[model samples]
Target: MNHPIAQRVPGRRPAAARRPGRRPAPRPAARRLAPLALLCALASLATGCGIRATSVPVDAGAAPSRVGCVLPEDRERPDGDGADSIVRLYLVCGSRVSPVEREVRMPDGRSATERLPVARELLEELQRQPGAMEDTAGFETAVPNDLKVSGSRDGDPDEALRLNRSLDALPPFALAQLVCTLADTAAADADEGVVLGGPADDEAAGPLRRYECDTALRTHPEAAETAGTDV
Candidate 1:
């Protein structure tokens, strides 16, 4: 027996259905993981380990140094005691020589002929420890307590000052302090600086040397020993 054919409907779409045994295609593994990878990269950029990233070079000057070169008080002059006079003593601060005011019983004279007395007094003041205020302000004296000063010998220059210790034996800063302090006082020629000699009795006493407390010495006290001129 023959079967009859079904007739088609004009301008009408047929209904679609999925096969029972088939499944839809799965998404690509790379496409699904791409968003997660991008998120991780962004997080790493935002939170660096410690330092920040910069394309431009930055300049921060030299590292900070010890001891601020500041004076603690406004004591430029001494109290009006009849016996005491105000004087400047060069002290080491921040590895440089700085002037500090002090009061001492000036040894009764100011003439060039009486330079030794003034020199001795000044040397003693340098050897003395810095006062409370001076110490707090980073002022320190390198001159030794045992160091002695005397008038120049017979053949020595009239303006020369003698030291018990050889000039080479003293520390550079100590030499610098002495030179700078004396240069500003009656003990030395203010323009020519100070002339120093070793002990009169020492066999190895070298020729007198003139040490200037110029801007160079004040700034770089370590060069004090080499900054002298043979007088």
Candidate 2:
């Protein structure tokens, strides 16, 4: 389901969970941090995933190339100090199931936090999965062995998709599709758990909505020329 964060970047929480927005200003860390920095830089592009319109034709005029932004609402918990804990999951390009990990520290040494990573190839599979539809219940799996989703002292949805080592042998989209299937099933299960545990004991589907802002896709000369033309 599309949430507020889908508009901005991947692997991120929603915006309200982030520091207030600043003009697309240049921040100090904007540069020098190549490699992984590309994503982080892009993350600063917009507060949330901007907007999405219906998928008309592949020729859908005016549609932006990217959809979904990671929201900042859920961030790595600050250096403990009595703050809520934070956990991050990364989808690497082409590694095994074991993703790199990290800890952001907790106020009380009693608890522990963990970050997960995955391969980029895996994430690409997440993008390609046909589940882009409204309510698909099935799932897909890629490299299930090399990856690990071990829980923390207190579990916080610690899951990441990344690539580092292991299977240089890529699976057909079938593999990625499998991972998608499992994740989806897990998400639905989580939703059910939330409702069951909610104070009101009420079950509510998460809010989902969309908007269209970019005119470039539809405004492009080729798209314009095709508009109102015979299918």
Candidate 3:
């Protein structure tokens, strides 16, 4: 049956309808990793081609050591009674004069005039013969027994002691002994070396002279020849 609207031409068919083309299926996971595996193998081959392993030497010895130590022993002490009241006086030992320490009994009085008495006592002690111990030790005195010493009140700066005899007539050693002993006594009274003058009757004598106790005078009494003399 033919209808006007549904009629088809004899040589040509109706325009064919379009259809979508099919996409390929995904491959297995292991099969997809094959390219990466081949790349890693090539890298390993490149690195290992020329490289070699190496080794170094080491020392094996013993260490060092040390020594031991030691210690010391103990000692004893000495006595010190009656040391504070002692005073020193120069005495002749052999040809040389040296100081000897002895005990002094200070008076109950404390006035400045008390120094003269102390000095007189010291001079008396000096004139006395040395005791048995001192004699045995070769210590003696050169101070004359009769020579007297008196304090000066003449307002003279150069006179501390007045002697009973001419200073020039005394032996060098005797003068040295007297000078040193007086010097020490003067020091006890906080005074400098003592100044001495000849007998009061010697108005014509030279000026008073000052004297000191020193190491050189002790070692060589002859050195006193120029010391304590008027210039």
Candidate 4:
């Protein structure tokens, strides 16, 4: 940020004054040369956009509560969409933005997407099953909990959502209701798709990779920028 100018002599004229002001009238050639100095100054120290180091003060209002399932984006996919909905849930969770397009083109030809905000539950679920946590976008929170872990301890948050969705395919929905009842022991307003993956310290390579990868991808883009460049 600091630019060094030639040391100014007290009695002598300053180096800057030696040249006429930037807008001085002169031979047409000199006027054309005027902007070149400023241009060179700009090219020397290159910075992309106005990126400054500061943990962005997260706008909590923009993010949904971790306590419950966020409402579905369209509520109606409009094309007899049912079977694959459950599997698609965990594909993206607990992310404010997706560097890739977070959209799906349904069989009916109309495409729909949602920018699901990342919550602790979503992160916890991803910790359990990183593969399942593909995009972490378009998740619809209709209930308080995504997965129902009534009597398991492996503590895979994201995978549990997939398992619970299987239970959602049950005959009468008794298991899901029971899971919700048990979760109410702690999360009183809990519902489906509200990710509640056991305690946070159960997995090692799951969500940790996501956080690390996301951080690195967002910060050190320069490394990848020139990755495939030809010498």
Position 221, candidate 1: lDDT: 94
Question: What is model 3's C-alpha RMSD?
Answer: 29.0
- Residue-level lDDT of model 3, residues 1-231, one tens digit each, is 765785676876665532447467789888988986777667768784344533654454655532111111231212224533455677888767877666665443434566567677778878878765567567788888898877664565533567777777677788888778767553233554767777766786556777777787877897776777452
What's each prediction's clash count? Answer: 0, 56, 0, 22
lDDT for 17 (candidate 1): 39
What's the lDDT for candidate 3? 0.66
TM-score for each predicted model, relative to the true structure: 0.69, 0.17, 0.57, 0.16
Go through the candidates in order and give each one's C-alpha lDDT. 0.84, 0.29, 0.66, 0.31
Tens-digit lDDT track of model 1 for 137-222: 88888899998998888888789998999998989999999999888677886475799989988869888899888899999999
lDDT of 4 at 53: 49
Deviation in angstroms for 48 in model 3? 94
* TM-score (C-alpha) between model 1 and the true structure: 0.69
C-alpha RMSD for every candidate: 9.7, 36.6, 29.0, 22.9
Q: What is the lDDT, from 0 to 100, of the residue 64 in candidate 1?
A: 80
What does candidate 2's lDDT look like per residue over 69-161, in tens digits?
Answer: 222344453353445334222222222121111233323331112122222322333443232221121222333454322221222232322
Q: After superposition, how far is residue 222 of candidate 1 from its true place, in Å?
A: 0.9
Considering only N, C-alpha and C atoms within 3 Å, which residue pairs clash in candidate 3?
none
Kindly indicate the candidate among 3 and 4 with the higher TM-score: 3
Off by over 4 Å in 1: 1-66, 74-77, 190-192
> Cα miss at 171, model 1 (Å)?
0.7
